[model samples]
Target: MNSNQQNSDHWLVRPSTIRGLWIGGSILLALTVFLQFFIKIKGYFVVDGWLGFGAVFGFLCCVAMVLVAKGLGRFIKRDDNFYQGGNSDD
Candidate 1:
């Protein structure tokens, strides 16, 4: 019945875990961008050859997807008790 019941001092909720995750992600992003200089793109798209292009593209795509999902949620979302005819306790 309590919100903290699930967390219960889990490591995932700790500050160290959050900091480590961000650091790891940044390192991976930087490494991939650095490698893009020597890696030639065989694709027809010119922007694909630019450094950090993939990361930017992927990030933009993710943002667009989240925006679209949020927009659609307004029309598709239902009340928590919509399936139970408003009697959620049942």
Candidate 2:
């Protein structure tokens, strides 16, 4: 095989990248689990501990963010002609 092909085939997946992903995912999972047990809103409109509420809330927030981003893209998105010839149609 050529040097280029060999290099491509043997490209390093750094341990740091793997470790970072594992740690990040673990933390998110742990937070969701922890929040499930210890989440309580004290005061008016208070909600007592509801199992899996944290995970559900987090998932719903993610979904809402994605939907909002998609909706905003339609209004705020621009073509390559944006900012050309001092035409700031933003």
Candidate 3:
């Protein structure tokens, strides 16, 4: 195969992968919205508001945590060979 053909193929998303992600995302979104109706945990620190708002707040908090983790991983990652030949006792 030519280099250009290989590169174009690398950039393509498989149909199954796209379908799986779409199905997974829809399920998660449904579960998030559904949980608000059927589940309640007592909180010592309650923000005075509607119950639906609390679920939205929790979802946002989860998203924020994911973003923070991604940022930290990028910031703290080392090159693959960073310590490959280093002397431990130096």
Candidate 4:
């Protein structure tokens, strides 16, 4: 590849950069969860006021959404040759 093509690659694609990003993100997430101890959360529900509740809830919700999407995909997905047939109506 030419110099321009080499330089065009995004920084996020690099292994070192990706590792650094993961570390930075983890630190930020930990900091937020740690702050929950000092900051009083005015939660509507008693369970939500617990330590790291928001993070756990958010992670669980994301997993549930992924599972729902996978389940829906099973019934809604079409075959690979669905649009490659001989007739337009088929």
What lDDT, from 0 to 1, does candidate 2 have? 0.69
**Which pairs in model 4 have colliding backbones?**
none
- Candidate with best TM-score: 4
After superposition, candidate 4 runs with Cα above 4 Å error: 1-6, 87-90
For model 2, how does the per-residue alpha-carbon lDDT over 1-90 read when each residue is reduced to its tens digit?
676765566334555667888899989888777775565534333432455555667789999999999999988999877757575566
Model 3: residue 89 alpha-carbon error in angstroms: 9.7
Quote the positional error of residue 13 for candidate 2 in Å: 9.5
Query: Please, what are the lDDT tens digits per residue for candidate 1 over residues 1-90?
Result: 365875676888777888999999999999988887788656568877677888999999999999999999988999887766754565
Compose the digit string of candidate 4's lDDT tens values, residues 11-80: 8786678899999989998999999989999889999899999999999999999999999999899999
Candidate 1 pairs with clashing backbones: none
How far residue 69's Cα lies from its native spot in candidate 3, in Å, is 0.8
Backbone clash total for model 2 is 0
- Evaluated at residue 25, the lDDT of candidate 2 is 90
What TM-score does candidate 2 reach? 0.49
Q: Which 10 residues in a row give candidate 2 its minimum summed lDDT?
A: 40-49
Is candidate 2 or 4 superior in lDDT? 4
lDDT of 3 by residue, 57-86 (tens): 877999999999999999999999997877
Error of 4 at 51 (Å): 0.7
Per-model TM-score on C-alpha atoms: 0.70, 0.49, 0.42, 0.79
